[model samples]
Target: MRLRVHTLLFWPHLVAGLLAGLIIGVMSFTGLALAFEHPILERADRETQQVAPPSPGTPRLPVDELIARVRAARPEAQPSAVTEYPDPTRAVTVSTGRTGGVYVNPYTGEVWDWGASGWRAFFHLMEDWHRWLGAQGDNRPVGKAITGASNALFFFLAVTGLYLWWPRKWTWRTLRPSIWFRRGLKGKARDWNWHNVTGFWLLPVLIVLTATGMVISYKGVSDLVFRLAGETPPTAGGPPPGPPIHVPVPPPGSAPLPLEALFVQARKQLPAWENITLRLSGGGAPRGNAPQAGPRPGGNEGKAEARKEGLAPSTFAIRETGGWPLFAATQVFVDPYTAQVLRKDAFADLPAGNRTRRWLRFLHTGEALGLTGQFVAALGCLGGLFLVWTGFCLSWRRFFPAKPGLVSSGDASTSE
Candidate 1:
């Protein structure tokens, strides 16, 4: 009976491992590469990361003047918005139109960088490879479907692999080969032992990674998970209802508060915040409120309803430095004219589902636990690659047994 069960699992595990290993290995390696993207980009652009703090007596350029300078610098480009870093030495990054953006010194309006290029651009490419196999552009559904299916298979493999790694007797002696590296082993024996040891040690992390990858790839599964946690997953229907704060249009000929002043005031409210993305009121939507753009099913209807309810200014997206950027953001809706903060939604104060949704990115990237987590995840990816390579070798050798005495005694016993 025990042998029959092992035989039953062996074929499927072997086949799935062979079939999905290549794609999973690619994903794992790309993910490992992406794990250090932030620090890499920081290092690549270290000089641009911060500028010399201006002389205390000198005032930073006014918001309109900065905008004028960007327009003057790139007259062909339409400046959309600017990201003000809390650090005075950091140049504000400006977004222009759809694809191109430039970083400009607030003190002197000097351009630092532009467009989808550099370490950031390389990571975006790696992200495409990681999630979609780089077969489709911009996360096409077909690519997602393929990656999702492979992730499911990988999850299945992890579970079955765990069962196979379980020693029948559960004795220290019996389990040592699975749990530790064996010296003096050669050929398939060494490969088999290493695969088992690495897989056993990294099993939990691989499981979590594949599980989260599935959640990200499948909408139904994501919804089911949210429901299981007693929360509704965000849908593409409409903007969520926010506090009932009425937005008043500024009087005719009255100027709105300066962008710099609003940020200065917001800084007062959120002292620890590292970055602020302010969308001028009465625009299409606040940057952070809606995750995606381009008309939704009821997008127009939702806008009409928001207009009816006077929730016009959905406000600015401010991010602090405590956790991953996605999870550490707080939406602050200010009275665009007064610079008065009307309402705030901090990450810690979010509902369970929203928080979980925010946390998904960090969990997927293994950055939720910081540098240590990143290192562990990178190692798991490395182990996953090794498992795929070794599993393939072991399977190949098993199908075509080696010459007499070439195979190890322990592996020979398992064959019987």
Candidate 2:
């Protein structure tokens, strides 16, 4: 029965590896490249983003003035958001859209666009391949579907590979070759040794990476995560509804509070904030009170409604030092004219499921646990590449076994 079961799993595993190995290899290589994307981009953009103060004790310009300078330089560009850093040397980033932005020297109010960086482009390309197989436009969903199915297969491979790798006999002699790489091995023997050892050692990390990837790729799995946590799942591309905030709108023709006032309020809200991002509503004057729900502010529909209703609120997202899970932020919504904070969403106050989802998102990239986690995740991706190579080599040898004296002496022990 054990032999029959092993045969059942072994053949399918081999076939799956044969069919999807190349795609999996692409995913692994791209994932490995993206592991250090944040630090790499930061270092690459340091010259563009960092500026020297003209003199000691030079005070940085106000947030509104920095943005004014950006608008003055690039009149065609509409500023949607501005990120201010605590560091005096760091330039203020005014974003027009996701991944499109300009950096302004805070001390000098000089505006400059984020120039083309090869490193940035390379990482973006890697990300495209990783998530969508480099698909563009409407074909991206198809690519995503392909990658998602392969990721599910990878999870299966990791699980069954564990079972096949387990030793029937409890002895170091029985397990040593599979557990550790043996020296002087050749051809089939070398491939088998590498496949077994790499798979055995990386099983845990591979399972984690693939599992988190599933949650990201499939809505069903994501919903299951929330259901399993005893919380209602959020809608696709949106968060679960939170309490509604009643934002008092100023009358039409009344001037909205200055950006500097909102900036000051955000500082007061999160005293230890390392960075603060103020998102502009881009609507003129206030007309009526509009209720805002969810942690995130200003979606397309919300902005449209706000424009029609003539209600504009300033949203501030603040990141503090020593925050749990590294990426969580506190969101504050303020009346554009009254300057009163309508709602404040802190990471600690999030639902358990939401917190879990955030962790899973970061864990997929190994950022949840900081630099050490990223290193381990990168190593796992590298190990996955080796597994695919050796798996293919072993499968090829299995189907076309050596005949009559073609086999090397080292290959004699390669049989399963």
Candidate 3:
């Protein structure tokens, strides 16, 4: 039977599906390949001032000693935030510049930065391609429009693909997908059956994943979710102003009350936390109750003193003035003096509009799941790649076939 035009919206959905499928398929596979690599540093990290525990009778390595080591190694660099993960296997991470200057093996002092790993470079480029389609600048309006339209396409594709896969009558012959046989070099029917059946099973996952992903890269549609949930915040775009007068915290090495003590004291007070990551307070300043920035580009970053923390700041994105430590799913802040956690939140804390934002973000990175999640996402990507290829081939044949075909595209006006 020939494809319909107006009723199914098949042709438009087919085209958009191809593009979205290609993007997600290639990107997801590369990400799956990249995950096997470790982010551990190889050189002496300039940002983190991690040191070994003090001698038996000694207190934890003094912040002074760590700071001294960092300054000694890289005098020109400005060490901003200091932090420590309670996990012993990993050294304290620091937030220095645009990139991370991780210092590991506090006792031995080893570090590694992005050398000539073409993989890292490719990974970064892939992210941009996925996010901006290689376009740069503050033209977020344009980016959103493109991604939003693409998302709508993804939604339609998922739905229609599901419908096409559903069989009207199930028989033993049709029950098993066609590809399981040894088609050594046989007909394309088995290939078609394999593709269609696999797609049917994977339909649910890809639909949600693709739709949520689109929601993130586009703001126009996101606003609808925001409006429905009453989650839009007017000041979301601008950074909060810094305090009129900055209150200076003592230098890194000078404080008698170590931040470890402070972190432990604080965690004791807060509940429902898996654990706390003690970061160096770099930028050399205190945390304030002001609005802050850091999700995407082109937001305000008011001037303030660098933040201070347990170790010299070098490893992570430290918020010196306002904002809070980076929460995997949500954001929160802490009061350094009293071990008090301020603005504590998780996924539940997101605005109703933004509530869906968290899942979208996780789906974007595939960190939203465990080992199984990674594998499942990878399978989805593979399925998408197959769907794109077969669909493209089938579509071309259906449209401008090399030879006479069983199917004919309804009309020239069917496609955009």
Best by lDDT: 2
Q: Higher-lDDT candidate among 1 and 3?
A: 1
Candidate 1 achieves a global lDDT of: 0.69
Q: Score each candidate by Cα lDDT.
A: 0.69, 0.79, 0.47
Off by over 4 Å in 3: 1-7, 17-58, 63-68, 75-81, 104-119, 134-148, 170-191, 233-275, 278-282, 287-332, 336-356, 400-416
Please give the distance, in angstroms, between residue 245's alpha carbon in candidate 3 and its true position after superposition.
17
**Candidate 1, residues 277-394: lDDT per residue as tens digits?**
6543223123223212111111111233335634454355666766444346666666656777766766665556555654664677777777777888888788888888898888
Candidate scoring better on TM-score of 2 and 3: 2
- For model 2, how does the per-residue alpha-carbon lDDT over 303-343 read when each residue is reduced to its tens digit? 33454454645667777888765767777777777778776
**Each prediction's number of clashing residue pairs:** 0, 0, 36
* Top-down TM-score ranking: 2, 1, 3
In terms of lDDT, the poorest run of 10 residues in model 3 is 311-320
The list of candidate 2 runs beyond 4 A from truth reads: 54-59, 281-312
Candidate 1 vs candidate 2: which has greater TM-score? 2
